[model samples]
Target: MNGTISLFSAEASGPGLADLAGVLCGPGRMAGFGRTAARLSAVVDEPWRAHALARECRRRGAEAQVSAAECGRPLVRTPFRVDLLSLERRWCRGEGKVLPEGFRLDGGMLRLWALAAGSPQGNNYLLALDPEAPETYERLIAALAQLGVPAKVQRGEEALLRVTGRRRLLRVLELIGDAPLGAEAAWPSPVPVVRAV
Candidate 1:
């Protein structure tokens, strides 16, 4: 239930789920987007939650599969693959919409960027945002500053945002909410190791 969010429930339709979906679609560690299909795979710690997620996926007309995790790993893998071409055709015919909320657009994009390539070291977190849209990246930087999360953008093939301190990284995480398991595991522990002599 930690990283899982309800996407199809009427009461669960909100910015949080939208943002989480964006992250899943953007740079999903266990997910992939292709020209024809969009696939999502996540390892949840609970079996029921994994089945629930699969049910949601089935309700949305996607192929869903759930498998128990291997020994020593207490997690279940749930994978969903949906045909994007059909979805796009339906969208073009005004059947569905996948627009980010105006107020949370920045936060959503930031979350996607972080999930795609955010690296948290001892006291710093470095994130790379897609440079394909420079304007969007600028807006994200401005929005982050407004929220008091100091980030410096470095221009290159793929623009990089550097969050210099641990406090700022934590604030970023707070704003973005849940991240992928791999990304979460990549974050260095705040408590330094003290080995006994």
Candidate 2:
């Protein structure tokens, strides 16, 4: 589901974003957070129970934050904003089962756009971290592709490349759907892409 979270943020917008945010940050929606581990044992597979997930996130270093939105979608509150409800859904049972946190890519470029090839919104996310380990990023992108996400991997600043000047890559990504990062899993990943020039 981590793949979905990554993909969702990458492709999120419109009503989908709102419905997800409402379930996450809404008052009384996270009531499950205050329960004992045993009480939540059954719903352990369901992370949308914002309260419980919030507690877990806090434990994992996700601080409490509020997002403002004109409509219903929750806005990003941090450099790495996420809708608890949407994230919860990704972590749920069935096809939605997301990889555990350890399976996710932590450092690299994480970008969120209003539309894949449209204007950027003020709410987009752009982050740069030391590149992830090759295997990790490979697993991450491969996981995304398996889940129907479009991804591209490049060398050095390539991963940092944006849609501003490049038309072909974006078109290809959109055309093929999502793809895995380029580079063999056996190699070391490149540096983190903090900005594109």
Candidate 3:
């Protein structure tokens, strides 16, 4: 499954709440959980992303809320629930994001990350990495490579992973599936998919 980037096959079934890991991968954080409970908050660039992420969290059985942050960015977050404890423990390393020893990226997780901070620049797709947690960048890039989406870390004001080449971009589409409804960022490059009628 790690060799010969094929666009047809599915990656292995991910573990419980693996999609939530994507939030930590980007700008999301597993915090605010103590007296009231624990919450997972993700600040996104668009309103559609707020709704999309909330819906995904609900689909995963978490109660979610979407609202605009003080910075005016839309924020989607889950309520303090005991169910999220394991996730917080796994992703938080003393207040920083860190992948568990063996975490896998699935379509849902990839979609969440894309919704959070991914964008398309020309023919290449760029995924923003956490500037605070520079240590996890290599692991993330390696994980993407294992999933057949080879990417390189592009250092800048904010670090990013740029996925280049046509086949690799197509492979990204296959792995992450279709774009979210009402999505405007178009990280996967939402093209007019034609069908044979």
Highest-TM-score candidate: 3
Tell me each candidate's RMSD, in Å, in order.
Answer: 9.8, 15.2, 5.6
Point out the higher-scoring one by TM-score: 1 or 2.
1
Candidate 1, which segments miss by more than 4 Å at Cα? Answer: 1-17, 20-112, 177-180, 188-197
Candidate 1 pairs with clashing backbones: none
Off by over 4 Å in 2: 1-14, 18-32, 35-75, 78-86, 89-136, 143-168, 172-197
Compare candidates 2 and 3 on lDDT and give the better one.
3
Better of 2 and 3 by TM-score: 3
Output candidate 3 Cα RMSD. Answer: 5.6
Judged by lDDT, which candidate is best? 3
Whole-structure CA lDDT of model 3? 0.76
Ranking by TM-score: 3, 1, 2
Q: Each prediction's Cα lDDT score? A: 0.46, 0.27, 0.76
lDDT of 3 by residue, 34-146 (tens): 64457799887778878988877876778789998989989898878777788888787786888888977766678678878887876678898888889988999988888
Candidate 2: clashing residue pairs, number: 9
Per-residue lDDT of candidate 2, residues 79-172 (tens digit): 2333344354433334223333533321111211111111221222211111322333444455334434434444564232122213322322
Worst lDDT window (10 residues) for model 3? 6-15
Better of 1 and 3 by TM-score: 3
User: What does the lDDT come to for candidate 1?
Assistant: 0.46
